[model samples]
Target: MSFNNLMIYRHPCIVKYVSSWQKNCKFYLAVEEVTPLSHVLPLLNTLQICVGLHSILKALHFLHEKASVSHNNICISSIYVTRDGSWKLGGMEYLCRYEDLSSDFLNKSRMNRYFKAVDSNEEKVFVNPTARRDFIDVYAFGVLVYEVFKSRESFDEVPNLDVFCDYCRNELQHTDPSQRPILSSILKHDFFNHEFINIHSFLIELPLKSDEEKMLFFRSLVGRLKMFNEEVVASQLGNLLLSRMVLLNGVAQETIVPFLLTPKSDEQEQTDQLFSEDTFKKYISPKLLEIISVRDAQIRLLLLNNFSNFMYMFTKEELQMYFLPELLVGIKDTNDHLVSVTLRTLADLVPVLGAATVIGGKRAKLFNDGRPMAHSNKNLPKEGTPQENEHPVVRDQILNNSISSIIDSHNLILPERSRPDGEEVETSTEEIEQSVDEDLENWDDWDLNENHSILINRLGIADIIEDSNDIAENHSNEGIKSIVNTKGDLARSKKTIADIEELDIKSQVQNNENDSFDFFHDMEPVINSSSKFLINEDNKCDVSLGIDKEVSSKLALNVNDINEEGWGDGDWD
Candidate 1:
């Protein structure tokens, strides 16, 4: 009968009954674990006692008035404390209905055990057990109060002793069974009245309220939740709030989350905060992880917006393994605002996820014609290998080729590929000549070799060079008359064979006309040690003639000395 009563009843102050069955001819009962009240009695202060006693009275009222069932076994040992510090009524072995209470049942089971032993003088006349059956439990509650107070030395030891004594004397301990107060009247006493107790009652009835009522209640409850400084109380409160997160509106949620997570306003009162650090780690953090795993955009966005308030509650490993992956889901969402917010959240996580994981990840390769090619070291010169200096002839040839290409590029008409059709481009000869001459002026910085065969071929310089030679010939004819006046002075001046060899020699040709032109006539005549080359009236040599001093004294060399040197080797050939 007791097991049936426990299994049938459901109340916050009652021990939560899980399931019961009989297997192998044995009875099994499962219930939520709770601590015996006697074990933690030493730890309770005045406030905790008020909170606990209120819970027990509510349980008695539930059994007596609502169910018309009498517990018949209310004692120190029957009361238990849950993890959240709320007291519960358990030991229901003597449970019976009010209609079933008779003298035989009271004498056999309830009237003898778990309370103070009755004295022989106190055993007076037996009264009608059914007339005042509820008074029996009320009288037992008076005895419970006497026993609890007797354990303390003075009123100062338990500050609310005067209140409990007044209630016991005024109602529960009345000699006439008719005069004793009922469980409902006993519950209204000042001993069970407190702010925390009222909050506990409100929470117990919260689920039955409408959404608008709950919203108003939660909004007002935020400021008062801080009064519960005990870890057990705060943890239970947090559990209640989390369980009802789906029911809460946005305004209520926003109002309560900061109170649960943010630190206390006063630093000195940190230890007295309702949601202490330990409570968060043990309960709130794991609950938050489960909450974030849900993909509802509203919940996700709310957590993200207020992430800074509670982010410290999670460890690095927890964020990395769980929270980080969940947060990244927002980035892939189709909503532009969600994606934008997710990007900002990821930026804040850079320190934890590292630069390479969050914002530093690799991007796709770019395909562009203008992209520069990567550098290569394949053509770099090797160490210890003798570096050959560039020969002036080859260097000059390369330079002239480059300059000639530039001039050609600037003067050439549009190619057929660039035009709409393969049509020939018409350009004036003067335009081509003018462009080449402008480019040649830029090369005056370097003392280049007079021979420009490579440059002439690349630039198509046949026409331009021919024109230049014609101009040079005209200038030379006029210069000869002036040179005749200085010829007498030049006849006495001696020169070496090297001076003649150093003179510049230039050749020119006309395009499409195959006519060769030379600048020999324009050059000044150079004399050697041999007097045969002197300009005189009797020996009037052609000013455009060539001279070769093949056997001069300075040019003569011994064949033996040449052979003695390595030049005689066949490798030189």
Candidate 2:
């Protein structure tokens, strides 16, 4: 029979063989062995269901368009499972026209037997026998999805079956068969949404519940969904499970706000109460961070976008020390979405950590390595050059450490200036130059003093001239007259005379010009010593200068003593 050959070749799941073949027969009769629905249902999961449903929909579309055929028997029962678990629609007995059949007597008998209950009904149903059969098959498929959500026997005794059947009947009552809602609608019913509700609140309310129970429940749900549909499992089941775990871990306070603000009235309030920001920060952040470290770009992007919305929950210290490095690494990702999310998280964190610290530190590192800005300047190399191959991690650590040292030093020095009436005095260039010149003048006066005279001052004449000019320009007649009246000018003159004598002695002795120190080097010690005293207006400077003169006199005496006590071979102190 033509139908038998077509069914055998097209429906691989049909294993039974026809006993005899009749030529010129419009219909083929075949006995096919099929795996029972009970055995097959256990193997179906959300992924398999999705794949199977998609395949069937495509097949149905092809049949309707290309083959000019419609599967009137499209129920799960009519769909046979192969050894490898894939499904194919097997029973096609209802697809042929009356004229295509060889045995009209047998066909009538079958119609009478099958339509007897329908024929007995008094009310006229919108009955095209062909269309009715197809509608019935679609209605049965809807029931299959309903059964999946319920997770019960397909035809078990249940009080809810009557209500469900009534709903299906109402939905299938559309005048145009094609206008009925497709299988996708039936699969995604609001009731099913309620059934697949997030269980976060249950764990929270019952804190004493065993972790084993939670894990069992979670693993079971995820396993089932993963088997049936991986994307659905990832987005719906996996996310829900992660959300619950995150909530239970006390980090939900951060993440739960958006959901709470738009509470689903259909879901229980207790469930809604479980979500919070703290749960998100504590549980979700770490989990996502872990995922980001290991997972592929696609998965990492998915997790990152979901996690980034509540980045404000992380503290500045946490973000800088922990999250920022990971976020920075993500900038190299090829996925535009991931790069955008990583940058957005950084943007949100910048205000919290102080933009200067985060962005400035990044900029500093980029500049150090000669890399262009992450966002700007496309002509710049993305990767570092050989010379610039220094690791950012080590550099960042060193920079942070250096910053800490600076902060500590600042703190240590800040208290000294925190006087109640202390106004910050801004140092002017003129004041600094005046101070330097005063020190130089003091050194000159010290050189003229016999008691304070040294052997080697070697002061720069050019610097002395520069100092004299600076002093002349800054010091008014009134300031100099006041200084001279206080015995300050005499003391300054004495120091300058001592300094000049020391310079004369050094210049007279140094014959090796090429090996000799420069004028700045020779005079630097004297200038530094004098500058400290000149900078301050306190009496300590005068006292320090007197002590310096005394120390110089003592050093001269000690040198004489050593020379006089010499026993010719070695000097004895």
Candidate 3:
């Protein structure tokens, strides 16, 4: 019967009866947790007392005026305060529906021991069976107010509660139930007219209000929201603003959500923030995230547009897990504005999400992939320690060695070429001179007398002089004059060859003076020098022959030719 009455006669000011069950033959009634007003009475100030008393009056009014039932047990013990500090009436065991007096209902009786208030037969409001049932609750309501204020040392302790004190003294506690004020009349007193109390009452009845009324209320509420206590906004107004039953329009929601986010304005120094840090984390942050997660793009945009205001309130883990994933949805949204804002918001989030997760591939290896560090053979080998023998050989050495081999084989005196700058190539010159000296020293030991005739025949030099002698005898002056000019041309050719410093393989030294003796330069220096001596000694002819001067001159010119052959022509052939 008690559960039925609670469930049936529901009001915001009445205790909410949730569910009931039987387990192991034990009956369980599940309801919201609450603290009785009696438990928190000492803690109540003037404003708290007024708000609590106001909530109870509304509950009693619901019973008497609306439901036509009587809460025969209205008292401080029966009033329960929820977590948000809103007061609710809970003691319904003694409630009676006078209009429904079936036999089964009539058998229900009120237990006298539990009735906190003393009753008398003289008072019709309490005992007269035929009396108005509402009068009983109204009188009990008065007693509840009196007991609350009377608990204080003096009425002066509470300032604005004078109206409540006066009403409790004269009207509600009146002996005649007809003279006592109605619940609606008592609610109009100054004590119940506080901003916090009115806001609370409006939220309690918010569900039944028209959308237009709610919009006006919420729009007007924007400025007035900060006037209420933070605890009230956090607990009551937050849930009420978001309640689906309220059917709040988008504008109404948009208006209220910011107030919930920053419950206190910048003007208040008493507390710069109304809700504590914990309140923002456990309460405000989750609410903002929930609003962001909603599919309504406008609502998501609203939260995202003001994300900075709420983002810091969320912890790091919540930002990554809840906030980032929801934001990614906006990035993928078809709305261009939403996607743009989402990308911009993500750019701002880089510091929080980090470059690895945002710009770079997060799971990618930043450096080496832990494979053994080894050089690949695909590329040319890197420059290593330079080789010791890497320096190039001098050109002089190769040229000089080749000339030396030909000189040794042909038994000749080859001319030594100079450097490119017309300076002598000192190394090659020294090597050639050393080889010539060795050959000359070897020749000095030879038997010149025995080998002289054989050497002349072998060289074919005798044939060359015989031809020159024959030509001189036939045209002596012309031959002698042509040879003089030819000798000059030969000397000029050698000087020009040295100036150019080039090796020419087919160099032919042509002398009009003596072409026959040109091959004389091909013989070794020792052989050429000794040719005249050998001929002068071995032949023993010609002091008066008149061709001796020409013969001697021819031999001298032949030795010069042999010397020029070694170096003037570079040909190995």
Candidate 1's clash total is 0
Q: Give the TM-score ranking, best first.
A: 1, 3, 2
lDDT of 3 by residue, 118-186 (tens): 333224343445756566667677777777877676555334676677777687767677777777887
* lDDT minimum window of 10 residues, candidate 1: 500-509
Candidate 2 lDDT (Cα, 0 to 1): 0.41
After superposition on all C-alphas, the RMSD of every candidate to the true structure, in Å, is: 18.3, 21.9, 24.5
Q: What is the Å distance of residue 247 in model 1 from its true position?
A: 5.7
Candidate 2 residues 205-248, lDDT tens each?
33455666655554344223323222332322223344434334
Better of 1 and 2 by TM-score: 1
lDDT against the true structure, each candidate: 0.57, 0.41, 0.56
Full candidate order by lDDT, most accurate first? 1, 3, 2
Quick one: how many clashes does candidate 2 have? 41
Candidate 2 to truth, TM? 0.24
Candidate 3 or 2, higher lDDT: 3
Candidate 1, residues 236-296, lDDT tens digits: the string is 4555666544324566566776566553433446432346566667767776888888777
Give all TM-scores, in the order shown: 0.53, 0.24, 0.53
